[model samples]
Target: MKSEETPFEGGPMDGRSLPVLVGPTGNPPKTYRIPVPDDAGGPPTVLVYRRVPRAHSKRLGLPKGWKYEFDPEGKRGGGPRWPWSKPDPAPDATPGGKPDDTHG
Candidate 1:
């Protein structure tokens, strides 16, 4: 159960890898390759996975998070924000119609 120990108890954990881009709000995006390994580990670890906004995803060629937003495309030119980043009003949306606030 140690953080560093692989969750898989019986054998070497099987895993697959994919590349992704990473960043915190205001920081430039950094590309990374993530492994979506097989369910061999005893339990899932939150070590490697983090969520980004759709705008960021599209800008960086990534996918959305759990919540589905009406506008898959992010704000024009604005990339995704950090999950914890405060929600902001869409540049073009009306006063009441706002963008969904969820990290992809």
Candidate 2:
């Protein structure tokens, strides 16, 4: 398929339309919606959908320090869970020296 054939060529994804893959083949295509947190903070979340290789899923551009997990029954179960809480901060060590990286 041609690159322009994909739905993303129109412009920045509106986070609603289903973007199909342009080329190549793999396991049966699946649809995934990633909820990106709003910079201003509100109830309206940006929902981006992708119908492509699982490896390409990371292109959704999740926020730094945040993470996500795939839900096999996503579309049926509502949607994938998001990283709601901040990740635990690394443990601190003596103030004089660099923090220990060996342990969490």
Task: Write down the TM-score of every candidate.
Answer: 0.16, 0.23
- Please identify model 1 stretches exceeding 4 Å from their true place: 1-80, 98-104
Question: What is the per-residue lDDT of model 1 for residues 1-104, given as tens digits with 9 covering 90 to 100?
Answer: 11111111111222422222223433223221123444886544322222234343647765443211222222233467889987776668866676676886
Q: lDDT of candidate 1 vs native?
A: 0.34
Q: What's each prediction's clash count?
A: 7, 0
What 10-residue stretch in candidate 1 is worst by lDDT? 1-10
Q: Which tens-of-lDDT digit does each residue in 1-104 have in candidate 2?
A: 42222232112353223423333632213443556677888865544333432233367853322112334343443345569945444466466667667976
TM-score of candidate 1 on Cα atoms, chains taken together: 0.16
- In model 2, state the lDDT of residue 19: 29
lDDT, candidate 1, at 19: 29
